[model samples]
Target: MVASGDVGVAFAMVCGAGAASSLGASCVFAVKVASPRVLAIALGFAAGVMIYVVFAEILSQNAIDSFQDAGYSGNAAYRLATACFFGGMLATAALEALAPAEVVAVLQSDPHTRDLLRMSIVTGLAIALHNVPEGLATFVGALEDSEVGASIAVAIAIHNIPEGICVAMPIYYATGSKWKAFFWGSLTGLAEPLGGLLGYLVLSKEEPLSFGIVFSLVAGMMVFVSFKELLPSAFRFDAIDRVVSTSVIVGMAVMAASLLLFTL
Candidate 1:
């Protein structure tokens, strides 16, 4: 039941939602200090928010819903979704293992900036990849019904605001440049508009299970990045477990609250 007209308006709607990441990234300027403790909390917060969304939103809700929309039913849909989840994890593991050490070192030559830069880049990439499906969904929703699409787009923009924080804060702490942080954070969101274009023209109509698969894959990639990159970087930057742990909880609370807004 996808209509083909209004491409311009739908594109704009998705772009507006995507830009919220930049809006969130801009918030880093308000923080007063650039310190190891701040970076730790940011990293922990990023991990917590991502981990919560992976379980509570992506895998639990979006993936299943997409599959059911594709005519999958009951436990069969759950089983397929779980399999795709593990497949995503294994794929990320393979890619991480295959990445050359020399390339990694070359990317960030400064010892101080090395791990933090790499981790943030990985986090941004994962988030960006996930946004593709989201963009598609937004475009399709808009094409189906403008009012509902606008409502969903606003909700998505609010949720993305925190994800922007997740991408920018660590980079700001690492490089001490608000511009650099915002640039990278904004880059991650560009995927949304691009995804909207691709989905509207290519995927949304013909491919029903694509969103479900992409959701599971990205959720896996996010969980992997949280444990492998975010948490470890947090511990390395600051030894205070109490602060990191508390920030992690706060991040989860923020993400949960944002997601709950979707239901209302």
Candidate 2:
């Protein structure tokens, strides 16, 4: 269990990690104005990051490792992980059902603008959902071992920068308001600390099985958002001919490098 004093330190680290998302959001100021192509590319880039991280880190590594920690191995772990992934997708679908297609009002007359806002919303929600379990894990880790927890938090913070951009860029481009985009991105980042608080109250580092399932579910959410929301909207953009595929690739590469660097 986490010590009382360590609780404060763990919470602080988790908050710092979450805040990195807002740091990523702040990057939006770099582009004061955006065009159709830029928006499409930004959406594609976000999707790419989520998809790559889901497959490479969340599912392939974290989920399986979690199952292994629970004493399951090989095919058993994979099967359960797959099941959890779909379950997460169903959860996202349920959340989607709560909102109509035109949930957010778009003042822009451009047809693609509606989809852009939708994509941003989907991305933000997915990122926020994913961050929760991560925060919990980090908090628990810090409770058990400060160095391990700190390392995880720092890696997550770096990972979150792109996630913040994933939420911020499309919103910035779609809404033409930096503050709105930053607000949404910052909002998603807050979920990390929320998770940390949840850990402090209830969860601990032990439930490998549960944590594994959660990791898979989060991966599923990313996959669902990427294919179901982000990519479709990106293709629908009028200036889609250029940048979509390239941006996606670049995002994937960056995510891969980020993961690799952490491993090394």
Among the numbered candidates, top lDDT falls to 2
Q: Tell me the deviation in Å of residue 48 in model 2.
A: 1.1
Q: Please provide, for model 2 over 1-264, each residue's C-alpha lDDT reduced to its tens digit, 9 standing for 90 to 100.
A: 335788888898899889988887887888443445765776677667767767876678778888988899789999999999898788777766654443222323253555888777876776676677667655655654465466556656755765676678778888889899899988888988887887665535557786677677766766776786666656766343588888779878876776677667
Show the colliding residue pairs in model 1. Answer: none
TM-score, model 1 to reference: 0.57
The ten-residue window of minimal lDDT in model 2 covers: 100-109
Clashes of 1: 0
TM-scores for all predictions: 0.57, 0.60
Best by TM-score: 2
